[model samples]
Target: MEVRLTREQVLALAPDAASSKAGAGLATDGKWGLLGADAEALWGECQGSGSKPYQTQVDLAGLVSRCSCPSRKFPCKHGLALLLLYAAGNPRCVPGTRPAWVDEWMQGRRDRAARKEAAAEAAANAPPPDPQVQAAAAAKREASRWSKMEAGAGELQRWIADQFRQGLANLGNGFEQDAQRMSARMVDAQAPGLAALLDHAVSGGGRDLPSLARLGERLGLLQLLTQAVPRVESFSAARQADLRAALGWPVDRETVLREGEALQDAWFVQGQQLIEHPGNLTERRVWLHGVASGRAALLQDYSHGGRGWDQQWRTGYSHSGTVHFHAGTVPLRAVASEVQGGTASAVPADDTFDVAAQACADNPWLPQVPMRLSAVTVAHDGQRCWLQHGEGTLALQLAPMPGWSLMAFAGGHPLCLMGEWDGQVLHPLSAWNAQGEQWERSSA
Candidate 1:
């Protein structure tokens, strides 16, 4: 039997808000007719103003949508409506053979996918370019970038010195604009990390001495980068990548794939969060814990202009997969290469608070370390809540509702809790009691 998707999953595939709304409006039986679904395909016809009904088909395996409607959207409203009806188990969508149109569309998609895979395989097996030529070209590119970055850094240092000479008190009137202008120069210097830092600094209210001190710290960091860029290769691969990332440089996907540590394990999804950034971009962060390896990895996905993500990682699920680690960081962050189907299950809390502290000890810049606290109880005093795990008690950074929810879920008993421990605070993600049932606590 084919797996059914939830209405939320179906709507998440829509390209934009307007498409989702339109698809929702067309989900009723009156708007759709002749609905049929097989193991491989789901097809339906929707009545529109035109004489002939619009044909819609969904490739179940790929979850690709096709519609004969005049809309330019990838999955037109008709396709979304068809999937909605099918997902809802509407009787109108009875089991049947796929029509010729649906079969033909599916065939085309399969062919294209096959071709893409073949091309990728061929490219991977191809021989490398001449070593001498490659070396010379790389050297030239590096020299050019070095010159640009050096000039940008020099200009930034001068600007910082000027700010210091003029004093922080006198720079309030146009400080924001000044920072933005300097940031733009950094961007022109191809130092995106520095630009982002400046933007971040200015975005925070630059109205006080503390803010000015923060700006000074940023300048100090940039000064370090100016010294580091020339001899980047001297650092470890992972550290080099981190530095480049900090400098707003991109890592080549192919390079990482070819030269990275591979770990195969049953990874449990701890939790996932979606954040919206400026310029209408969405950032998705998925945290995973390797059951056997006891390793934590983070997978990041980004979508632009209201488009949805390519893949979905549900919280509280576990799956077998191979994750490739980027060189040079501890408490590793990785990119998933292959993931088999996942099953909904309770995530085991095996590691302890000391594990988090050790990770932070290794990498002080690490913002969050995964920790599992066993024999832990929520301690609330009507004003604040804290988690008493093992020998240590730590305060939780949660609002009233989530804190109360945790208390209710624990119910005065010691439960195993899983969450990230930033050096100072514990951000609970999920928890499970002795019976292995998940303790439903909303993320704060």
Candidate 2:
């Protein structure tokens, strides 16, 4: 436990305090801490003699419980001292003593953790998945994705049949346009499924039996997409988003981004979601952060094809700030539900569709988790480089390799794959799509 520091020791450790002698202490209500010019709250508990003065700490999100000590737990005095030291510009953090109060709390946490371990061990020893139950979930996911894909395939097939009945002369040209639309739709279907279709369509002249087999497979996939609706309620919200993407549902992110592109304006982060297809593919997302008004806009790149690709993307969720779309040096910015359009809402609600398992039954609550992706550069040889994201990075022979997506970060290191970066911590971007149940951590 940390020794109680005298007021003098606290001030001595604070180099930024304009005056070394502190005013009477109770601003923190018995918690002796220091406030800095930068507004970070820091308090010191005295440590061993005088060799070490004060132990400072900064806030880390999503891990700590709230501190009800009158101080905003967000940047309590502990955090202030941390900022003071950090602001001094040295990146190192020193180990310091924990006061009695904090120590007591830590002990209680350890006890609870031990209890949790016992409970988990008990759960692990339980029986295997009821084959019936496992079958049910897998069946549900497959059925769902297959349904939509079947419908899309049927619709496309009908269109093709109609063209054939009309005649084959202009069929090729019509097929070209149709293929382009289908290609975009495939992208919406979360990539892997789309890739399968593309491979099928491009590999054959339609009369080849192999191509025909692929066509049938695409139809089967469409069926899976169609059936996913009923199963949406059965899976977690996040899985539902992924299943939807697998089924080819549109995220409409491209719409928001395109408007930002045309006007070169800022967008709000309304919502974010991620989905995993059957293959090595995974998606990332960020809800576009929003802005209310004014007129300044960021410029962007124009595709020679003229058709904008924004509508296809789902909104991204994390991140804040303004970005110049077309500018090269600046990394990137985010999405929008333009508050200027009137509503200046903070943290947009998750819009990804949720098809939970028979909400008709008692089950667990599952929500979609937004996918985070970063484009990183990969080095094949000392001299060669390729920008990789998603599965590409996973397939690489790099060191420690990379993590799955921006959604998972480890000790300041990026965890996910995104195409396009050759590895210089570039602006990470995501495809914003929705899927369901297929990636549900638990069916229940």
Candidate 3:
């Protein structure tokens, strides 16, 4: 069967606004030399300013795109335009056999995937390592790393104290450089989590009052982490894991799958958010809600360069799976295995502020708490957007485009909204109308 995709979905795959606009402009038939698609892939050649046209192809199975253009961006304008044409059901994208170039690329991908699968199978079938020997080596490594992190934490504590003594007003001139230097030091000290905290503290330049306050808050958290690192052994197993994670130590995925907490349920994909960081790194957070257990889980994935995600989880769909959660005082991040697509189920939006407050009380370091509110209507007060539910209102951290999209979808009526609450602001990711139709903020 031919691959089918909506125009919104095609646009969502664009790497940036410029790419989206350029792809849209190139979607017409006259802009291309040849365009065709089969069940497995689409191929096209777009005439650019160069002497020859650029060959672009897309694998329908994975939505992977490749173009013979020099652009580092994945799904370059030509590839995106090709997909857009196909999505629009343009007559030019008629069914055709795969060309030699497209067939070669697809075969290479299949070969690589097969090799990876074989390696995984071989490893799984291999003999188990000696438990005693493995344990001794692991313990030794952990102890050495702990020593370095503890010393680093002490140094950071002193640095924070020096800042307070010098007064926030004196943090001028080269303060940002100093912070960056300190962050690098934390990385050398094998405490990348601390390094990340330091980076966040100074990210705003410390010029505005709000930025200064955020810096102070981050510093306070760093201080708390410093104090806890030395006494981590005294905490419970789950608390120790939480503390270690805060200190930049994380359990491996295999370990989590083998020993961490696991819950099997029908999980509804509530929404997702993609955050782009420096160095072309992208972080994706997919939120899921359990239908029977009424628990929320977060699936985090990362991609660098132009590589895409390993899997696509559509909003408003259900998947039956076993989610293995990382060990923590309040386990939220998880890995889903044995997942199979299922019919979408209605997510009861009955959560309240008390639920979020309780989560915060349980885990002070928690950055975002998932919330689903029913009968919530979008409201704007000239400058900012708000989500009004019953007698209470919460500020929304939404861009103008998405805010307008949400307003248009809601049409002044109440809807069920799913979002991440970061103590103060609610960043909406999806909303469902009375008819159960979903409007995803990511598509905006």
Candidate 4:
């Protein structure tokens, strides 16, 4: 498959081509030679400010892998920006053999494909098990899990009681180690629900004295499960499911990965934080904002047991852009601001909440505001903001001062959608809606 981009389109996409080329930053005439007639489908390369160039080849037929950048954002910005440059007739070098960097990438792809094929082959060749045999084995395992859960819950309850008796001076004051140890045990006991609970012991996620009584009541239930198996049995099937779910007892990974109902828009990368526990499950939060809708969204991609996100995702403040992304089963939280806008005027007053909004603040450390995640549709909404296009939105209320317009997405769910009655098309803002016990973010 061949990809083509008109010269003018490239220029619009790559505002830096003229300046970069005029500065003689690249090989003369080679840019166009590489672009050729079907430049859009060609491979892309990246040369850092002072580093050697790294090349990436994309399979035009499949829009699949073949890049040197260590980013996992499918068809990352580098890929899109490269195409944009070609469309502008400013490609700086003629396409040629894969560079050493590109070669490494090719080999990596081959290795991954080989592993996948091997795994599939192994599964296919596995001996079939009798259904009854499997069922009986499963029952025995279930019985063992219940026994383990009872012991774990009983121990956890006693631990909480001891802490309370010692006087909850500082649930978080210096319990990081304790919290971590307990959470790890909880995970082992199939109570991943308890790990975050342990984290909350100090994070203020516990809701403070204001909600302490309510929290105690919740804990009391877990404590009861310690000594009495019958009490655990008393819990309704629904309640049992809830308890197990909170325990993080292995839900269908496929379901968590489903991510239904999406919209394509420019998701702002607002703030980011990485979390790791003793067991080493790593979670990354790459928040986003839509420029047109001025809505906020979150891009949460996690890895576990010593693994991490493919890359440290970037946040951006921008003119406007779009991309393809999926919504999670639950909405993630985020802080949305412009990629390069001036410092934020102020964060929200609520200091206790993890999800809060702020004005755009282009932290001076980054090169420029990150680019759009994917191609986006532009709507002339009267409001001055950008957001994910589907269930979420970004309605930026640009203030008079040179500051940022920001919104918060709690648990990544849009509590309310802010839409603008554009002179023509109505556009979306931030979305904050509830879905079951989880929240969702919009890629749509």
Candidate 5:
């Protein structure tokens, strides 16, 4: 098969850092036997401590893997190493017939996919439910959920007040446990969004001033949300939708496609980032800029148990797509229902700090806003890296290596930098030089 994936892309599929390191180490020819590939898949036998060599195969189309290793992690280290070797164009992985085991596995995967599609088609063609009955049931369920959320919000409000009255410094050794318990309570109350906020407050910072300030800010936002719960009906539809979303009520994909705001534009893929969460879950965020509308959009995808994302978006490319935006005061998150082929495009880097500030002003709860700074140079002052745009400078929240890479790429010249700004720090994702050469943040 024509392996189009870069080494970085292949490593991005690793479940964790340890897997990525181990896979890279095993990519050398010394670790494997009978490595082979064809148009459909790649298969190899990795010699482990066991009597028999472990069999690993990867489906190129879906980027899914099957391995004989006794590991719960999907696409275990052996599978990752096999793909890594293929991606590196190692001589050992030559064109060959598919093994019987690999053939059976690939066929089973295709069969299951076909069955799922057929089932979905059947459901879509099935007789419609009674509209009034469906509507009533939905309304009842919503009302019950809202009632539970309101109670949760009230309890949260009280908890916040108690924290302030007792003073944050006095929370003592049980603060972490208390926060965990409160977060669990929010989950039981069917307010996962609130629970997530508490979790962030617990994990986001230490007992420092800045961290405490952020914690206070989050608590204040929660206070406002709790106060708004009772008066939600008085707000506009969009505002109510925002409040509901903040309370952890998600709009289904079908509902978003049918009722949410739709915009058709050639979206420039600015950058993407992957965040690893608890429970072996990874969240990928892809930021896009509309060429015609001059608007920003975010596409989020989640992978559980290392199955991997459904799509891969490359930087420095533009795709013609229709994005259906989720309901919010500031519509940024979207679902791309239709995306055509991608073509190389220049980075649309015209935004400044003011844009991010205004976005935050409009929606205080927004965690991050995309920014593209024009004519910016990376500056390192012995301690941290900063982006120097004209006379203004923004602190960069980047690791040392990537920061050095950005500085080196600039070579003492100005470049267009695209990144996400979270009020205090700018996280650079991709950069383009004056000649339009692109530099993406390393997945490693």
Candidate 6:
């Protein structure tokens, strides 16, 4: 089916204001040659400063942009210009047979999809394995893991009780070192999640009683996990999964796909942000707000060495897909089971921050929650920003670069915006004007 994108949607893909302006400048027929659009793709050649005109194309089905230009910014000016021209229904973008370059890209995507389907079919039709043998092997592994965890928990319990007896004032600076050593023991026992909590506690170095109290709470949670691990089989499936995750067991993607609940909806790609973690790993969290279900979902992707993740979904885009949710009490996190089609469309957003906060109460363990506010003006005290809507205000806690970008887009005017709210602060990710003008900054 043929797909058309709006001007605001095209601008939302721009990395910055300069790129938006430059892309708009190149949208005219005078700057482009050999533009064409088929049911599934858009292609064009943009005359640029270089000797060779840049070839640009958009895979409408996947909302993926490609350009034969050196610019690293996603959906570079040439690609956006091609899209804008197509969105304007320019005569040059009339339906035609795709060129070699376009057909090659399309074929690659189709081949990958076909291979995935074949693999899934093969697995489904394969004979069942010997259940008895599998169960015996799994039981043996579980027993060994339990033994190590038991020992580690015993050690941690003794250390925690000893700290209380010694008293915080008497422990001196060495107390922090003791915590780190215990944290290392937990890591050795394969409880990296507990290790992380201990690391976070000691990182503050008892600067305040409130901080110490927070540490106590984390320790309490760890102790609870230790208790739960021994009785894991007795707990419900969802609770067991939650306990395992809290104790550092990794989520099994295959298991989730095989047994997890699935929901299909028009998911609005609200916002995304990157988080730095220990061990040279970086995580990108993307939020999707469901249009029909009125539920939120989180897509977490990780990369090593801080290289950064590619733009999978742009802000202000809508993706119709099937999502598989992990086993949990509040299933806000999910994996995209199938991405059918992605388009730029306006989706309804909750206007009040309170409503968003209430929704997060279902999954209180989440560090951040997705929120959307309508007609909110950006207020600056020359230091930071506050999203003011009527009588309420939510502070924006963003890094220098994104803070400036948000300010430039807001310009003291009210906007329909989407962002991440971390209880205390809001990080604005994208904004749209009344006239459908859009500005998005997905990084940081």
Better of 5 and 6 by TM-score: 5
Clashing pairs in 6: none
Cα lDDT tens digits for candidate 6, 283-385: 7778888888887888888866423234556666788888888777667678886775467778574674666677556544444677788988887788887
Off by over 4 Å in 3: 1-42, 45-104, 114-118, 121-128, 206-209
**lDDT tens readout by residue for model 2, 1-444:** 122334433333321222121222222323423222111222244232345434433222112322323221122344333333433432222344544544565566568779999999988998878999999997897666656555555455555456446544334545656666765664554434543444454444464565556554444444444445455679775466555444444434464455434333345433322334344343434334334432222212222211112222222222233432221112122243332322222322222112111220121111212223433333334433233444443223222322233222222233232221212222222222222001111100
**C-alpha lDDT of all candidate models, in order:** 0.74, 0.36, 0.83, 0.42, 0.82, 0.74
Model 2 worst lDDT run, 10 consecutive residues: 435-444
Q: How accurate is candidate 6 locally (lDDT)?
A: 0.74
Q: Which candidate leads the pack in lDDT? A: 3
Report the poorest 10 consecutive residues by lDDT, candidate 5: 305-314
Question: lDDT tens string, model 5, 180-274?
Answer: 99999999999998898788767864787777777887777778878888899899987887788777887788888898899999998898877
RMSD to the true structure for each prediction, in A, is: 7.1, 23.3, 4.7, 13.8, 5.0, 6.6
**43-148: candidate 3 lDDT, tens digit per residue:** 9999999999999999998899988886655567888899999998888777888789999988988999999999999989999999999999999999999999
Model 1: residues with Cα > 4 Å off, grouped in runs:
1-58, 64-89, 94-128, 157-171, 206-227, 230-238, 305-311, 351-444
- Model 6 off-target regions past 4 Å? 1-128, 150-154, 157-171, 205-234, 276-281, 304-311, 352-363, 375-395, 415-417, 422-424, 433-435, 439-444
lDDT of 3: 0.83
Sort order, TM-score high to low: 5, 3, 1, 6, 4, 2
